[model samples]
Target chain A: MFNYLKPNNLLKIINKTQKFVFIIFLVIISIGLVEALILSPEDYKQSDSVRIMYVHVPAAWISLGIFSLIAVLSFGILVFKNKNLSLITKSLSPSGFVFNVIALVTGSIWGKPTWGTWWAWDARITSMLLLAFFYLMFLLSWRVTDDEKKAVKISSYIAIIGLINVPIIKFSVEWWSTLHQPSSVNIFTETSIHASMLLPLGIMTAAFALFSLLIFLMKYNTELIKIKNKGLDRL
Target chain B: MYGKKVKLRAIFILSIFFSLILIVFLVFKSLEENVVYFKSPTEIKDLTELTSKKIRVGGMVKEKSINVNQSEVNFVITDFKNELIVNYSGSVPNLFEEGKGVVAEGFLKDRNFFTAVKILAKHDENYMPPEVEEAIKESN
Candidate 1:
């Protein structure tokens, strides 16, 4: 088990996985794009515009997922004082921010067709905007702090505090009457989803996952390289 | 040295964990039930099936279609090809007007008219909202 924990060994695993994930990612994205853009049946009601769901939903999911991950990683760094863990968390922040912005922008784009307004203060929409701001606050904290350890600690607290918004965003429809529609993705629901639409959505999501992984790896590797160069400079 | 090594290990593990979550999200999102798009009457005629499913419809307000009775407002939406009658009973946007592009969100009733929960008016030239532009372009 300890042998499995070695850095070189772990790096080897990551490198191998990256290659396979990259291929899977490419295939999934291509399939999803084709399915979403062409194969999926036009919505019985919305016609072709329903295609936006493929992009909007995934972007929203990724943004939320990324923020949650960042918070968890930040917590680990603060509680354990792990340098590399902190670096990884730091590296992930910008990407998380990008996804959050994408989610908001895409949601608005989708909204204009459905809501008749580009922006609204509805519970769901407002909470998501708050989540985006939480990400921005975490990113800004790093820029303001000179001490890495202090920054990690403060950011971790901020992340944990910000997590309160996630649940609010999720349950906004039920807790309060909002113009935004309620969740239709619940596992307990008995709705029948068509295969043609499902397939493309699945493929696109896979592609997005792969794309995020590729970005995280590239960013993490750059961070490692930067630290190594700093060490060399010390010599 | 052990501390540094552990830190490196944590980074690897966290990255993998995050990646896995992303993969799962992708799969789940694709499988989830999706919201239907809103279409103009002209676009709806081209669809293969139509029944009780939720949808959005958009078009310009015909000049004589507006009928107001207290909070409820009834109007007809035309895409220059087909027309759909719409009924709304909520606060309207300032820009809502006749002969202007509008999108109404909701579903069609058995009565052969759209019952809108929300209504949006299109902005001006060189500055149309992305969603409005996308919906308009998509129907064409």
Candidate 2:
């Protein structure tokens, strides 16, 4: 069973998939950027500023999406006793952290002109902050633990525990009265969004998803290489 | 040794399972309410009808329109052609001033005044915050 699950075969598949996905990501991003910036109509009211949504909303979504993936992967490792799942979740951490930071920073920049302040303790903002803090705690824990396996186990637990906040962040606007507006896009209801606007949003979201997959593949490959090298050294 | 390893893995796995469940709960909860967009005075005027539902209003401070009392601050937000008078009772941003763009989040009780729960000032020409920018764009 272990022989059939050879790392080399998995690595080859991941690399090939990553390259293809990367090309798709770039194509979509270029189209999204051009459409969002040039072709999309300037909002009747916001004029040029509406373009920020092309970056802001997508980044926000990716940040949340990555964390959700990490939480699920972490849980799988802990419950199923799968080292591979733990490794994948660990590999996802840096990219997840980077995207979350981007989301928060970009959000603050967009908030200033509309909200009157750069920062607020509103439900949405505060919950995101908490998410960021959890990420930091996980990263710091890695540094503190000397045993690699111990670190992985502890971080996985932390990731799972922190998962509780994801909902609080998402629903912060609804559960409690918040200054942050509620979500515009939902699966069940038809959106009132204009085609021009929706096109760029869709494109950017695709780009972000592809970009995340590409990063995950690269990181996982690097970890695999490191593990192989260690095995060779022991031999 | 195998038992120790398994125990560690179990704890890690259980934590992740619980977290995933929490995330699903949060995402569903967040979907319950629609995020409201902020509209400027000019934008609002062109809209078909006004709903009593909560929304945000964004615009620039009208020159000389600010009236500040001990705790309350009243001002007018103008979007070139139209203006809405806003009454804010909370702390104001440092950059809040005449002629700068701002967003007030709350609801309109009547056509005359917007009672704001939060006031966000649009800072610097090139550097309006993301939330404010998104709000202004979406509402338009």
Candidate 3:
């Protein structure tokens, strides 16, 4: 299972599949944009502003999901002592942070017309802000350190510690009083969103996930090449 | 080759453990005050003092309670047992209407009055805000 993730082997796989991933990502995103912008019915109440959800919800979902993935990868490093796992965690951080920013900005844009405020100190909003802080700390661990090994170890720890915020972000609306509304799509129960709205949202989410993976592969490949070239300098 | 490296690893692990504890404590402490809970008109009426902290009031908009002017709109939020008047000076959400559930965020001026900075309607038609659901339930 873990064998495929070895740096050289993973680099070979990425080199082979990068084009396919990019093509699929482009196709899915184009279809999603069409469905979201043209096919879906305008919201009865929010009107065109509701279209923002097509981007905001998907970005928010990916950011939270990727952070959880980082936690799992961090644990894999502990169990297997694999440097590749640490490098992968580093590669995924920027994508997650990018999505986090998109979610916040889009949410604010949606909030202004609907919630009547650009921002609030609501539980959901605050926890997400905290998640962004954790992302910053993870990235800075790499930037501020000269020792590559020490930076990897410190970042892995930060990733693990940050896992606590994921569940909080998921349950904040249910647990506390917040300006943000509860989730529209529920995994176990029936979803409140209509199928027409759901289709574009699903497509957008798939596109974002594929795009993140594509970015991750490119980043991991670059990082691997840098390490391979520097192998002798460290010794 | 063995003892020094093992000792350093142990210290590194311990420091991370302590830092995690400190962060969790600080987060909860700050969140304790910032977390605002939803209160119905009945609940607001029960309160003896008008605190300065921001609060959210949720309930059905009273029938014919809305008074619109050039600058501001005033309405009453009711939970059957009690009602609190809310005044605001912004563009209300399109869904804001009489007999619909709405949540207003602002400060309480007195037992019966609220000056709202924002009025939030439901995010979707099928989804009612949980606070509004709870307020309706409590009212019944």
TM-score of chain A in every predicted structure: 0.88, 0.92, 0.94
CAPRI tier for the interface of model 2:
incorrect
In the range B1-140, model 3's lDDT, one tens digit per residue, is 44665566556655775688688768776866457547789878887777899888988899999999998999999988899999998878877888877889899998988999988864533533344456767999
Tens-digit lDDT track of model 1 for B1-140: 35876677566656754576566457535733231224558766666667676666766888888899999999999978888889999977655778766767778873357888888764322222245557777999
What tens digits encode model 2's per-residue C-alpha lDDT throughout A187-235? 7766545666778888988888778888888988887777676763210
Q: Which candidate is the best by lDDT?
A: 3
Q: State the lDDT at B16 in candidate 3.
A: 71
The TM-scores, one per candidate, come to 0.62, 0.67, 0.83
User: A1-235 in candidate 3: lDDT tens per residue?
Assistant: 5544445666688898999999999999999999999988776456677899999999999999999999878766654566767888999999999999999999999888876678877789888999999999999999889998888878888888888788889988887656678888998978877677889999999999999999998998898778667763221
- Fraction of native contacts under 8 Å reproduced by each candidate: 0.05, 0.19, 0.29
Which TM-score values does chain B get in all models?
0.59, 0.60, 0.62
Candidates sorted on DockQ, descending = 3, 2, 1
Interface RMSD of 2: 9.5
Model 3 TM-score is: 0.83
> For model 3, what is the error of residue A2's alpha carbon versus the real structure, in angstroms, after optimal superposition?
5.2
- Which of the two candidates, 2 or 3, achieves a greater TM-score against the reference? 3
> What DockQ score does model 1 reach against the true complex?
0.06
Better of 1 and 3 by DockQ: 3
Candidate 1 all-Cα RMSD: 13.5
Better of 2 and 3 by lDDT: 3
